[model samples]
Target: MTSVWVGERVRLRAKEPDDWEAFHSFEEDSDAVRNGWRLHPPSSAAYAKKRTAEEAEQRPDLDDPDLVIATRDGNVPVGSIGAHHSDRDHGTFAYGISVGTPYHRKGYASEAIVLLLRYMFFERRFQKAEAWVYSSNDASLALHRRLGFVEEGRRRRSHYANGRYDDEVLFGMTIEEFTALHT
Candidate 1:
């Protein structure tokens, strides 16, 4: 069996088709596209397949990062995480994660982020990790800060969401910074 990323409360492993079945959009307050976290939900299975293919084209040297977060006890599908735009030459990557509505506040997302980062940094030998989140996304902002991602920059009023423009914040962490946090 392939190795899985196990954390205190969650496990990061291969995404099953069931995971896609359980996949859903965020709450009204957290509409991913408007918040600038994603472009749109896959329209259909065919579209999802095509999207995956295109993503593979962009990341020729790498396979898809299909890490799904599930409860360690029952292995119930809760969310998905991906490390995209990976630069093996530079040992850097950008990542995004999505959690199902039913899975919120169960610490699934929190543990998944930790496990994914650990796998990327230690297992994959990555040096730096980055993510973009809207400044209005208090949950994400707080999570990134708590996880040691520093604010690298910001683009004010760059994204239009919820009938108004919201600022996009860039957060990043280096291997050194990650080590300082975990060690």
Candidate 2:
């Protein structure tokens, strides 16, 4: 039987000690970092390796730990996805996703999202999912729209990037909507 974490082209897996290379490579991609989340100073390869090990060890304690997005065939690391700001009392959560530059538009990110959403809605019992997108990140904005997430609202000029401020667009979807569309 197919596993819940397994999707058409990608599978969600726990972070490994050896995943440092992929993680570090992602940090080097300025566009990926800026679009996916706020930019920060570059990190050293040694730091990335240490951070991956530490995070892997602490995964069990996290309510929703980050998962590596790997190709189904060779299990090659392509990106990462994770749920955050989970409010168990309110049955709501938000997630962030980042796919490596070379792997863009290959459907890996979409399938990884579907896998995560299914697990969150069905297994974790989260009623709603939300995503925050930067106005400058055209790819993420389009991806969310294509996945059926409604444009809930926008926090204007809240995110500063590239020496300019950009609006943060909020997108949301309920379990009912997810079921109707995905099931």
Candidate 3:
């Protein structure tokens, strides 16, 4: 499937080479770092490699193809959403997402997420979509809850960030749930 998903206010677009600067900026932001679970710097070369592999997949789960969440009008990059550990054979996926520091509370991440989930379940035939949110991330927790994700489990002290361990909250939404929520 194509990597362009249009939403009311945001669009999840394919990661183009031109988007590197915006993506790098989002990754390097100090505030984003504090809330983000993964702290490592993203390399431009690695991003390109991932894109190449994604395009080469014969049966690509569009959700596994990392995309930039940009405004629908000017297409300004604001965030990212990607599925990793995607087990298409089992129809399951685990995803990660973020919106830039300046774009928080604007409903961009939520819009991007719902579009991606729709692509995952309806187009890619995914049975379920899952996420691991850092327990301290109130915004993400609330976003998942508002998007109809069910809290599945918790791994206590599983993530180390900001010189302390944080719990990882597991959330999942099955295809039936996705259909019910959307339809």
Candidate 4:
């Protein structure tokens, strides 16, 4: 049977200990880091390897650990995606995705997101999914819209990056809406 985590061009898989180099490469993209929730100093190779080991150790117990986004044909790691701020009581959740600098605009992010949404809404019984995007990140903003997520709200000047503040745009989609569009 086809896997739920498998998509057209990308597949979401458990992060492996050997995936440290790909994770570390993502950190090197200054724009990606700045557009993300927080900006931090550069990560060393040792730190990345350590983090990968920790994630691998934690994966079995976690319902939705950060997953590696890899090319379907060769299984080459390109990025990562993860669910966050999950509220099982309310059937709501949020997620974040990051594609490496070299892999941008290749449709890998889109397919990975669809796979995650399908798993969350269908298998996990989440009613709604939300994503927070920085205003500075135009690509992400467009991607959410293209995927049929509605703009629910925005927090004004809530995120600081690149010597300035950017609004955090909140986008949401319900299970019904996802079914309508993706099914």
Candidate 5:
């Protein structure tokens, strides 16, 4: 498998349909299911085929890119990262570590994001990358902050989740800033 970006403990690679079961497992996990706005309940398989087809047809040229994170040990995919162009020269991303219940808090998310940002800035030549975080997801907000994604904007009551209105925080990082930070 080709590596997208290699880091200390993990590498990013292209997602394959063979990963469907694993991806589904992660998405179905209790925490993941609750946090993922668009992801339905674990037992629902309604859109699996369609989602797989969509991801399979995605072209890397104009964003809508997705990558899987695999640990160095056995190359098992632990998480996923994805980005799409919101507009020319500007892009937005959503990422999550579905590293199974056993692998949480093991730095997989951080590694996946670091590789994803490197690819977005250096490979795809994007000007900026942004992520949307739900207001209550403190772990994700903290992760974004650590990665230099500053809080650029927020939409109050933008999303309705868990029977409540939730705020959405937008975090962004520029190509220049990413390069400088890495260097």
Candidate 6:
């Protein structure tokens, strides 16, 4: 598949050597990590340098593609959305929006997710797509529901984060379901 994709308000491309700064900024946002799960906290400057090298050595995910989506005015990356796979035809996706430190309430995540789903179902030929949202994440739950993903199951008390074992909501949408809805 091509490394670059564009949507109405955003673009998905390959992660480039020049995106080290943006990648570092994303890694440093503790609030962003807190809402979602992040395996590690990264220092901005060091991560930027390391990310450039990492991109060279690793395969691209939906978000990590040499991709950037801007407002068409300034061409800045507001956030990221992409997938990673353990094997062919099965992959998990991560998506979010972070224009600045204070731009959380905006609808970037929704827009990005809509486009990501379209790409996954139509372009990637994925049979199904799955998303795991922290149980307390009402906004995420609502968003997935709106996008036609069914709440298939949950892993109760599955994660021990922030001093609690929170449940994880499992949501999935098959390509057939998505196609039928759109048609």
Cand. 2 TM to true fold:
0.95
Positional deviation of residue 145's Cα in model 1 after best superposition, in angstroms: 0.5
Model 6 steric clash pairs? 13-66, 13-67, 14-65, 14-66, 14-67, 15-65, 15-66, 62-82, 62-83, 63-82
Residues 99-148, model 2: lDDT tens digits: 99989999998889888999999988999999999998898899999999
**Model 5: per-residue Cα lDDT over 1-183, one tens digit each:** 556577778877776666666676776566555555555644545466557557766665435566777786777878777765546534544444445655667888877777877776677666787788888878788988987878999999988766777789988888787777765
Off by over 4 Å in 4: 61-63
Name the best candidate (by lDDT). Answer: 2
Weakest lDDT window of 10 consecutive positions for candidate 4:
57-66
lDDT of 6 by residue, 1-183 (tens): 433255455555445566667656666666456557644754667657776767656765533233344443355656555564423535444334334344454665665666666776666565677778878767677878987889989999887666777788888877787778753
- Scored by CA lDDT, what does every candidate get? 0.73, 0.89, 0.81, 0.89, 0.70, 0.61
Q: Residue 8: error of model 4 in Å? A: 1.3
Q: Model 2 scores what on Cα lDDT? A: 0.89
Q: Candidate 2 — which residues are off by over 4 angstroms?
A: none
Ranking 2 against 6 by lDDT, winner:
2
- Pairs with steric clashes in candidate 4: none
What is the Cα-based lDDT of residue 43 in candidate 1?
A: 66
Model 3, residue 38: displacement in angstroms? 2.9
TM-score of each model, paired residue for residue: 0.79, 0.95, 0.84, 0.95, 0.80, 0.74
C-alpha lDDT (0 to 100) for residue 163 of candidate 5: 77
What lDDT score is found at residue 159 in candidate 4? 92
Backbone clashes in model 5, listed as residue pairs:
none
Candidate order, lDDT descending = 2, 4, 3, 1, 5, 6
List model 3 lDDT by residue over 90-163, tens digit each: 99998899888989999899888888888888788889999999898999999999989999999999988778
lDDT of model number 1? 0.73
